[model samples]
Target: MTEGSKLLSEMNERSREVFRRVVEGYLSSGEPVGSRTLTRSMSEKVSAATIRNVMQDLEYLGLLDSPHVSAGRVPTQLGLRMFVDGLMEVATVGPDDRAALDATLGSNERDVGTLLDRVGSALSGLTQGASLVLAPKREAPIRHIEFVSLAPDRALVVLVFADGHVENRVFRPPLGQTPSSMREAANFLNAVAEGKTLSDLRGHIAREIAAHRQELDGLAQDLVESGLALWQDAGESYERLIVRGRSNLIGAAEAAELARVRTLFDDLERKRDIVDFLELAEGGDGVRIFIGSENKLFSLSGSSLVVSPYMNADRKIIGAIGVIGPTRLNYGRIVPIVDYTAQLVGRLLSER
Candidate 1:
């Protein structure tokens, strides 16, 4: 069993009941739950004093804490983690939500960006938290390729894929590159692009260039290599990160919480950092949760992240989708939503 389970095993039934009630109350209201509150809701009608002693014991075990000396106890980060891992009962996604997700994502839309935006919007709205989506790199076969010279030194490479995706990228042409060389490059690409993805075409070109079998001149060869290299270096810039409903994070923040929300806003502004952080989910099999200081990016804000990796047709992890919200957010409810959404996205991507 996990450490959380072990800790739970050490607690007596009465202690467990009180702890569960405290965590549940805290999660629902984002406030400390007192002994009287637990006594009123507990099944066995335990006295308030007995519950208070149990809370003090739980607090000593590093599972609960009080915001003020006179106030009741709220679950600490450790307490929340323990509750989530051991005591909390996760709810299944309802039929309405499941149908909603299917209707939104199962549309005939082939555009990856539109699908991803819809996913972000849906998750954020449902969870009432900020949604983050890491879009996977596309590898559809190339349909057509063109090089349109923009300036003497710069040119635009327009690439169309078989999946109806078009990408335009700008590259600096080699010195002495002319219309003739650009045409030659386009012709070469069109010749070999049939049923081949950009990466595959790049490999074929590299092999041909190494064998010195191409008919293109030096300028055109350089242009082809530079254009391919540009896409490689761009590192999935074609709609990689989609963040939605950031304003939803600011709802119902107390004056004391404003600074933390500001800190979270600052964290969100660092898109690169968030992307890097999401990459950690790529290594895991299913849903993972990070609370409070568990994830460094949101440590200062004391936020929680519930993320799950979506996979490709080959069962390989491709990207991730998740939510960012306060530590007191509804873990039981939101967790299954994230898990189901990740599976749905994987299936949709596979079908495409």
Candidate 2:
């Protein structure tokens, strides 16, 4: 055998059979796997002593984790990875599940961001697991944008996009403003800024207006600066956000351990960390399954994030879709579900 193939660790046929049953059981129950459980469940003939020895070998190889003497062994992260990569069969979604997923992909008349929020909410509700939706930062094309003043000290900005999307923002006025002044600002902005990004237009206009030593009154300058700040800040506000299933996590985890769970709840209150994870996946290629130690942000809270890229009509990865669940997730089921959801998100975007 070649060196590379030989280095690929695996068990014999009989041991493989036992390991499969053990892993599946552990995933289903979030519990350890005792030799008796394997021996009784599988038809493979093996002595308890032999199974014990094999478990020892697996532990040595970092595939099985032995928590304590009285407890049984469980699959470690590497073991789970290997099982997912090599042994996972593509489990089909059932009829109700298929209908549900199709329904989710169908009901939204919203833009990408709102659609993602709906998806996240659905996944969390369906699986009773934490769900996260990640939208593409650099790819939401501009259709149209406008600004209106709500008051002398308050201005309203409305953004419209080619994808039949709209967004709104309210902010402080530059210093002093009026309804007629707001009209001039909106007319001027809409005329020159119909097809540019909120940020790009804001920056370009700020530079041009500031450079002009020529004309307007102090009030017009104030209107310009306030509009610029509102544009910049509102652009940031539209960024991808994370929505977690606190209840789902609670259901999956030991809710009895309230202190630790509360801290976990508090950590996700910012939603920034999960957004960072989405940004990382958007910056890369396709599917990403971040194990426990791979990311410290997740490691601290014992969570795992699985993300997959979704494309637009131009075949650009305009966003990503995935689930956020506890570390002891059923990768066998959730992995395929996540992959399928990503495809659905892409298809929806393409239609738009």
Give all TM-scores, in the order shown. Answer: 0.79, 0.72
1-352: candidate 2 lDDT, tens digit per residue:
4321232344677656655666787878888888877777768677777788877777777778887785488877777766666665656655665567778768747556767777777767766678767765543457765667677677777867765667787778776677666666665566556777665675777776667525645666666666676554335556475565778887777654445456667766755465466565776666677766665555656667777778878887666677767767766666667777788888887787
Q: How many residue pairs clash in each candidate?
A: 0, 0
lDDT of 2 at 118: 70
Question: Which lDDT value does model 1 have at 241?
Answer: 73
Residue 342 in candidate 2 has what lDDT? Answer: 80
For each candidate in the order shown, give its overall lDDT on alpha carbons: 0.83, 0.68
Kindly list the per-residue Cα lDDT of model 1 for residues 1-352, writing each as its tens digit: 8667788999999899889989999889988899878878998978888888898999999899989977499998888999998888989998887887777787788788899999999999889999989887778888888999999988888888898878888878887889998998888778877788765766787776666545678888888777768546263555677889888878856778779988888766656574565566865678889999987777888789999999889998878998998888898989999999999999899887
Model 1: how far residue 173 lies from native, Å: 8.8
Off by over 4 Å in 2: 1-11, 108-115, 135-194, 199-239, 242-244, 255-261, 283-285
